[model samples]
Target: MESMLIEKSVQGDVESFEKLIVKYNRYVYNIAFRMMGNEEDAKDMSQETLIKAFKAIGQFKMESNFSTWLYRITINVCKDELRKRKETVLSYDAPLNEDEVTLKDTLKDETYNPLLIYEKLELRSSIENALNQLSEDSKSVVILKDIMGYSYEEIGAILEIPIGTVRSRLNRSRTTLKNILQIQLSEN
Candidate 1:
């Protein structure tokens, strides 16, 4: 189905392209949100990414998956946006709004203890804070690998670097994150 949509969109079918956009819209927006850390900026970047992808569809070789190419475009768009607003960091907070119930609430009958759940959530928030301290390059590599679960080769293609470079970046980023995590742990 995705292949057919890509083919039809490439063949100038507007509806097909629109369908593809709708299908991947949330996925794109999530990546942008992780990179930008704001809903408005994420929406703007996501729109820009789709527009750029549509404009460049003719050049897409299909040597890799369409989603991979689209993800690469999304990452590039986020990088460009990050460049203009370098070194900005978001203050990490527990997602404790009414719409977002605590992990304890979600774990109703689970075997996991409530204290453990709270601790894990706090740890996750701390990791996110440490991530905010990283350089954009390191943050991008970490998010693409650890959060989004992209393989090293895919990351290389997306970042337009060699797989070895991606591996090294991931290693360095993880090391930095681990050190930060340790500091946070000791301080707590």
Candidate 2:
């Protein structure tokens, strides 16, 4: 079914492309948010990714995973924006107007205890702060692998790097994140 859509989309069918947008826009937005650290930038980057995808749909290889290709476009867009802007670290406690629950929420346990909740929120903030400290290369690897659950092979494809490089980046990023979190904990 999706192959048919991809085929039509490649043939310059607007409707088919719109269908593809409906299917993958949220994934693109999630990647954008992880990369950009704010809803507004994520929204804008997601739109830009879709536009780029639409323009390049004809060049998409049918044998490849469509989601991976879309993710690649999204990552590239975010990387470009991050490069131009240099720095942006937004708070996670900001208002959420939509009903879409993110991966962060899913990983968290549903706890009613106030102290546990507070600690969890604080830890989350520290982790995000740690993530922000990582270089773009490491941050993308960690986000794609740990947060987004992309396999190493898939991450390599999405980031257009070798799988070995992806593994090393993820390993190094994880170690750095752990060290950062440890220091934060010691300070508190």
- Pairs that collide in candidate 2 are none
Off by over 4 Å in 2: 88-118
Which residues of candidate 1, in runs, are more than 4 Å off?
Answer: 1-3, 88-118, 183-188
CA lDDT of each candidate?
Answer: 0.76, 0.78
Q: How accurate is candidate 1 locally (lDDT)?
A: 0.76
Give the TM-score comparing model 2 with the true structure, all chains together: 0.78
Error of 1 at 130 (Å): 2.1
TM-score (C-alpha) between model 1 and the true structure: 0.74
> Where does the lowest 10-residue lDDT sum fall in candidate 1?
89-98
Q: Write the per-residue lDDT of candidate 1 for residues 53-158, one digit (tens) a residue.
A: 8878878886787777888899889888788876554222222122433344555675665445447888888887777666667878888898888899888887
User: TM-score of every model?
Assistant: 0.74, 0.78
